[model samples]
Target: MGIKALISKPFAAFTISKMNKWKYNAVAAQEKVLQNLINTAANTQFGKDHQFSKIKSHQDFIQHVPINDYEDIKPYVEKVVKGEADILWPGKPLYFAKTSGTTSGVKYIPISKESMPEHIKAARNALLCYIYETGKTDFLDGKLIFLQGSPVMDKKAGISFGRLSGIVANHVPKYLQKNRLPSYDVNCIDDWETKVDAIVEETLNEDMRLISGIPPWCQMYFDRLLAKTGKQKIKDIFPNFKLFVYGGVNYEPYRAKLEESLGFKIDSIETYPASEGFIAFQDSQKEKSLLLLADAGIFYEFIPTDEFFNEKPSRLNLGEIELGKNYAIVMSTNAGLWAYSLGDTIKFVSKNPYKLLVTGRIKHYISAFGEHVIGEEVEHALLTVAKQENVEITEFTVAPQVNPQKGEMPYHEWFIEFVNPPKNLKEFAVKVDEALQQKNIYYKDLISGKVLQPLIIRSLKAASFINLMRTEGKLGGQNKVPRLANDRILADKLEQYIIEK
Candidate 1:
């Protein structure tokens, strides 16, 4: 066996065995996880405020600490940002993951010393689980390239601040660093366009066996690599490449283009990591759904999406969740977040192993006309249209055009950037509209009753999304086009580049 196999095999086996045990007894495992989290933070300010010490069961904990979003929790996070001790966690946070804020310019999420290791461990186990299930260790023998954010973190108030991906990249274990591509100096480049060029230049000839990044940026890397080498496919340059690990956005829309670029079918793994914590990952080689990390130092609660905006919504624990229900995920993590709403919605697909598919964001949707179009429905419609028309879409976003100045009703406007334009744009738009109507009954009724006009399709100029991302100041890792918006804020901003078809 190779050195890589020698190092990974035993650990992979152990992880799979433990994961299997936890899978069957997820409820019991989660209960223990919650108790441990409560005990660990019982003396902290947040814990005391929430009466964590007095809480003994899930019922008591839920009643004590109400569910909260970023806005609701920002005050406590602000205390941590000001270098206050024991505000959220026991001591000051090790670092703050700077992400785009919902109401403010930026959000500083705490990363305590106790929680940082869980983030790293969950990430490591994601790969180990893949290896354990697939018996694919040869890829580990070659260099792995992770297209992450700039590793140069800025320090503020004695705490480091940067993207979660960058923070993780900066802390890559010494052993793995030897097999990781793109030297640290190149990774430190802050400008994304320049950094991608440097990455292309540095790893052009390396034995790249794996690549991991969000889909759009990774597509940029592959496009540049192909352009530089004058190659038909990526496999032409890196024959050993075997895997692609991706997260942050749905990979279905970009799958065709990604596979085309690679020139061969390769195993792909998906992970659900956020500034809050690493939540879940694809555990089985045969399944697309992600297995929830029940024992990964984070306690999970689910609130039905339909009632999440209600005055008082019911929350379900791991034991109470039913299959095929959409829920807004609430987490109480080792990072000291209590009943925190991550804002993302997910639907459970399997019950025994607790596998789920991320549906969309809570605030990201179109309900301007009472049609209630969601991100999942939009993605499914787009995917259906793309398949029917044999076109490849690079990026897309939807917004409700609420005010029609002319003698017409308001409609859902779709701005699409296509890599391969459809043979007939009008037909493609009709098919997309029909597919959406089929998926959502309310949307169908609205269209049939003429309460809402037919969906409008406005083709975007090639690479227009890149300009859009630049204008929005979210140009790189972990940032993506917001798929659906309730208002015309993003649509009006992108109107200048729309091809008036």
Candidate 2:
């Protein structure tokens, strides 16, 4: 082992032990976190406005604070943006994570001095847990690359603002600084394609051991690496590339194609992170579940996804959540967000140690008909059939086709970009349709009752999704194509990329 591995092993063990303490006492940990947040923010303007001093229990909290979306907090956020102090939290925010918003145009999420360390700590502890589980800390010695957004920060009234991934880039630990790939100058490049080309050039000949990013962007990086070096598999270019750290999207749909490009299977770690907070990470190699970060400076709540839009949805605390049921995640954090809805859906996989899987975005689902298929269901259906048929899916999305030709039933249109096209498109579509039907009984009923026709597969040429993303200026960073959509907004754009065959 290299000196780095030697140093990290003991530290990894220590961190895992400390983290396990929270796992065993998850409920108490959250209670303490909520209390701390209340006490710390008791003097802030929001605290005063909400009668924070009188709130003592979760019930009290619920009575005083209704769940808030970004618009609900925008007025206070505007105050912070104008350099106001003690408006939301204790003081002015340390940074603003700027994200593209729908109605608001751009959302500037606050990251307080007290909350920033939790993000770094959660990321570090995730790696530590991986090392402790597999005893493979040697990756730390070689070059590591995180295919991320630019590290450039735009200052507003003395506070830095940038993509959350880019902001995290600025906080890399000193120990790994020398080993991290893609020089600062390259990372600062604005355009995705240009930045990717620069990353390929920098890491083409380096001893890269670990690659990290959203799977699609990482796929884009691998494509660039292959084109630059004319190598068939990524392993040919970086033999030591053993670990893949990915977040933001489920990897099952991308697994077959990604491994085909890699030339072999490799271990991976999935993380559940957002601008709101770093929520969870895969703590074990044996299971896909991500251990929730109860002690990570955030208190969490859940409302059953079906009831999310209800006038008075039942908000259940962490200990009250049951396994395998989809719930919309809500959070209150040291960042000054109180009873804030994350707009993400998650299902708990294990209650003992508090492990969960991100099921979908609360708003990103196909319910045009009564068949409300979610991100997890669609991914599972497509991935299962792809693996069985020996087909490789490069990218795919499902949108409701409520409008159809005369005398034809409406259907769900699946736009797929395939590496290995199925030999019989009709047969392949039937299998995928059946798989989805099995997962969603509502879809099955619609099909059997002749309410809708089976799904249609519109296979597209290679790089179709990539080109669309590029055209839309979302080709990289945290951006990803949605798995399911209720409307044809994205489907209409995808039509132009369809392969005529």
| TM-score, structure 1 vs. true | 0.97
Winning model by lDDT: 2
> Per-model C-alpha lDDT, please?
0.89, 0.91
Query: Ten-residue segment with the worst summed lDDT in candidate 1?
Result: 1-10
1-501: candidate 1 lDDT, tens digit per residue: 579767797889987887788888888999999999999889888898888889999999988999987888888888888788888778888889998875866888888888888788877888998888788899888899999988888988899999999999978888789999789999988888898999999999999998999999999999999999999999999999999999999999889889899998889999999989999998877888998989888899999988989988998998898888889999998888889999899998998888999999988989987787889999999998798778998899999877877778989999999988987888888899999999999999999999888898889998899998887777888888889999888888889998874
Candidate 2: C-alpha lDDT: 0.91
Please estimate how well model 1 matches the true structure, expressed as its whole-model Cα lDDT. 0.89
Local accuracy of candidate 2 as per-residue lDDT tens digits, 1-501: 888889999999899889888898999999999999999999999999999999898889999999999999999999999899998899899999999886779999999988888888988988899999899987998999998888899988889999999999999999889999889999999998999998988888899999999998898888888888889999998898889999999998888878988999999999988998999999999999999999988999999999999999999999899999999999999999999999899999898899999999998999888889898888888889888999988899989988887868999999999999999888999999999999999999999999999999999988999889889988888898988888899999999988873
TM-score per candidate, chains pooled: 0.97, 0.99
Residue 209, candidate 2: Cα error in Å is: 0.5
Position 294, candidate 2: lDDT: 94
Each prediction's RMSD to truth: 1.3, 1.0
